[model samples]
Target: MVNFTHQDQGTSASCWQQAGLEQIAALDPEKLFHAMASVIVLAAHPDDETLGAGGLIRMALGQGTDVHVIVCSFGEASHPDSTTHSAAQLAALRHAELAEAMDMLRAQGPRSGTLHLHCLGLDDGKLAAQQEPIRAALEQHAGERCLIASTYRGDGHPDHEILGLLAADCALAHNACHLEFPIWFWHWAQPDRQPSFRHWFRLALDASSTDAKARALEAHRSQTTPLSALPGDEVLLSEGFLQHFSRGAEIFRATWPGHRDAASAPAVFDELYGEREDPWEYRSSRYERRKQQILLACLPQERYAAVLELGCSIGVQSAELARRSTRLLAVDASATALAQARRAVAGMDHVELLQATVPRQFPQLEPGSLQLVVLSEMGYFLAADELEQVLAASAAALQAGGELVVCHWLHPIEGWPLDGEEVHRMAGQLGWERIVEHREADFLLEILRKPAGAHG
Candidate 1:
């Protein structure tokens, strides 16, 4: 069962006080102090700002730092208490709810303050309709030096995904920093399938901040009850945000754009998503089977000095990797999944479990010491350019002629920056020489060798 910080002692408005216990482990003092400067929260709706970054905003305000909120919509059509209400009425109530939420967030104890709130007045669900204006708002406010926080595409919310894309564009246009926080869409996006390392910001809310967060979330009483009702929902003891730094020029990925054909990517989900006792059973069932097949096909039947597998969800693949490598580092973002992985691979002496995200450069890892880097079912989560950085970082992590593997699920995701095929094409652009390419009925796997003479 998923563990969450439960807040039964207080009203629903104060539930957020318990939201961060899991997230606090990810934060350190250095990261918290870094976030004290300018902070920006880009929300698809008013409640989102509170849901995702309320603790961080409160921290910024407490430190007398600048904090800005950009709300894409007034959430005119969202109201959990009024099923019989019309859209117009719902909009009115949501707007009022947002005003109250903002007050609770910025105001002391029970009063609202004059914190800056920017609203685009876009249609709540039809965020794509207001893309132009949304883009402009993000670009205008995302000046250099500001730390911006937005939603991740995996949240399974359309508006939130668009906001993520818009935030990426703003980061590119103004060269600012940006992060993605998971929110309500966690209802549908499976826990094991979500991106682990993409969130760059790691923040912890203290006990007092937790109290303020609960009160701030409680202020949106109409929204919280329903959100908390979603499957596996739990109030957190602490809350935080995640960030993925940009690699180069911002790469915009849209199915609507005629970028490149993603026809060649693998569709792993279609083959494995059957009714199972554990929703994440595929990690052990079909996922493990396929990963074994890919490892056997790509890796030599010999031992290696070192190997790194980023986003190694359940160590299904990492176990097989352990047999072929001397030392293996497996990292994921979910502590629960990592715990399960630790148990699954407990007997393997050469494996290490870590909590981290992809598109992240593990500079501390022994550079030029690793022989192989495997990224499976993890590439599609990032924007196009970010994938390139992951490849570069993998190259840096490896010695000359080191091996790098690329694998991603091919089925169409609603708002991914690029499909699996586009990610592979970008990998080809890197200096690595292609070694083996496997095309099966379900997935695509490619192995590339770093040049011995040229630096990766």
Candidate 2:
């Protein structure tokens, strides 16, 4: 069973408060604080840094770690109805407020000149449009190894979600630890509805750090206090809302290092398919062409009654698998990739292509139904635990003497969570009798089978 902080909490507190507190108790602050030499905080707007992770910034600086903040937007549109300030004036005011907040946070630490701030100055409410520039800015400033804290992707704001994704990407690219701080998610999202993969943890703030956070939040008067008397021009951050951040601990969540499930996988293929149908040269690469031929030739049976191919990107291999199977289920996480696959296999009625994420979205097959299961060049996409789930599900679906073929690249991918060798080793430990093992300079192909007399 999946262990969630919210599920184990036995408290009379509201669901939100219990969930927040549960996450807060999960991590040891003393260890997490000293593990990093540098910290980078990515904020969608001026006040987000302070509201979401001001205490964390204070704690990091006090521990003598260098802290850098990158603000993605000036938040001019946050108060669009302000009678006292125009958008330009509002942007300038938020900029000044951010500097003041940084100053307050810096004052809590012993080191001078340790806190640095960079304002991307992108248009407010349009950071999504400037993803490339924002990503470039993050890449330029990111240190070799640092702790990156950004807004949670599920923070219910477009700018916050986009910046969070870019920050995660930059962190993964640089091999840094990435943390997500929620601003609006705490206010609106139900605890049970949060993504399962997020490893929730909390950073406890001492009195001094808490005081510094309060001062930092006070710096953003434009948000906390009302600017105009007009009924429509409301205070963006109310006292009740600010109370959530003023607690003794701040809530945070981290993504799986190097490997992400469907929820957190970088939108690489989804965006790549938008530009061109074949991004990785799936259809025309000599290397891929040979691998596909070898894969088909090594299948144990001449024809499979039922076959399932996981991560069948663009259905290049799916087209071939369709010819060998009475019915084939080809599934991939990217709908864009599946759309192209549909076109490639337009005339194949036996091949069914679906956009589904695995382990979670895996189709339920009756016991002893499927004769062949193919996991090609896709095992590295799952983490260790998810791979086990896939292995168990596949084992349960396979018929007597069924073949499970796994082919993966031997080389390690920089940001992928699992390597091909690790995936193959786990498959070997599943009590299946090894049938064929093919080793190449660049890849490894292994075929395993259930004993013919084994019960389903």
Candidate 3:
């Protein structure tokens, strides 16, 4: 099990002080609950839902709104040092604790009989590998005009982060509002240093609701106190940790509206290719042909050691890029596009094609290893925050003085959240030196060099 108790007491104290230095804006509970058709809570562990949003859940239920709770794990590995109990025994105890916690929450609400609960029973500490199954389960329960709540992605836990990403995707797919609550973030994150992209609001709880939340938290006996009589066993939820949650209100942040869903861009291309093999006419258009030549000619070096071509649809650009690169790895999200790309580049031994979704399943390149990267006609497919992540990844993988070339259409597509200019504007903010910028009536092309000694 991961040892969260090892966190330095001094640093935790500093974080707690910073957390309360500035008060977060208040969110009106009546306005929030009245607008939601339903609510879905995704908890990475047994007590996460209670620790983060217990009061919010009570208010929603008391208002007679339908609510669904999905607990992803039974938290079997939390007390790995215990000598009196096996992992199975700990898991069984955690399950019972969760049931009791839910009963305590429901007892405080008016419509206590209507809340639905699901225990996935997934193994603790391994949720990152099981994203697909968890995502499918969340999608089944999510619906339009609903509110989805999950732990914040930056909550300092692996399971919580992955589930937060999955919850954002599900919320976007169902057109629901996504709210993220902070759990461990309060123990480490400094309030003033939070990222500019994050917006936060606190759900104010009255004295009665605060007391109810405290009682609900007390139901998880295994976490709040010592779990076993073994010599090494200790309380997982220390007094320092519980102090962060003792406030009268709980803090919630927004995620999906600013971050694009992983499936949204891929789904658009999938449907477009379903109708025709070449949706953008990369093979036959004179404009595309000239654009490709301009992109190739703008390279600073005559030849690159290795190159990555993101969104290499049908290998049209990959075939030309392969000649200039000793080794080329081309990637796209659509399997249909990759099938054609595989056939198109079959004769080239130096080229490799892989199907991967961006900002999620990127190539694991060694730090500062890649010599060049090409992003062509694909930036608009991502949201502002998603594009930022891709840019950061590219910066991390690029060698010192490595080149990044971007070619995007000037106009906006009907369903895309970002336009070509917006994508280029965000890239400009990454502090890379602009080496070459070519503008045309139809498209915009730019080449940026990674500054020497810079890291992503």
TM-score of 1: 0.47
Ranking, TM-score, top scorer first: 3, 2, 1
Clashes per model (N, Cα, C within 3 A): 24, 2, 0
lDDT of 2 by residue, 1-456 (tens): 122221222223255566545443465666876677788899989989998889888888877888889998899997655777889988999999999998888854246328889999998888889898788777777876578899976576778878776887877677678888877766654454443323367777888789888898899998888887885467887766677787777777675445554444427568768898787788889999998899999887889989999989988999899999999999888888998889878988988887776765678789889999999888888755457767777887899889899999999775667788998998887778888889998999999998776634
Candidate 1: how large is its RMSD? 17.4
Better model by TM-score: candidate 1 vs candidate 3: 3
When superposed on Cα atoms, how far off is each prediction in RMSD? 17.4, 8.8, 4.5
Per-candidate Cα lDDT values, in order, are 0.60, 0.78, 0.80
Better of 1 and 2 by TM-score: 2
lDDT, model 1: 0.60
Per-residue error (Å), model 1, residue 212 = 1.7
lDDT for position 162 in model 2: 81
Q: Cα lDDT of model 3 overall?
A: 0.80
Q: Per-residue lDDT for 417 in model 3?
A: 71
Query: After TM-score superposition, what is the CA distance of residue 114 in candidate 2 from its true location, in Å?
Result: 0.7
Worst 10 residues of 1 by lDDT: 242-251
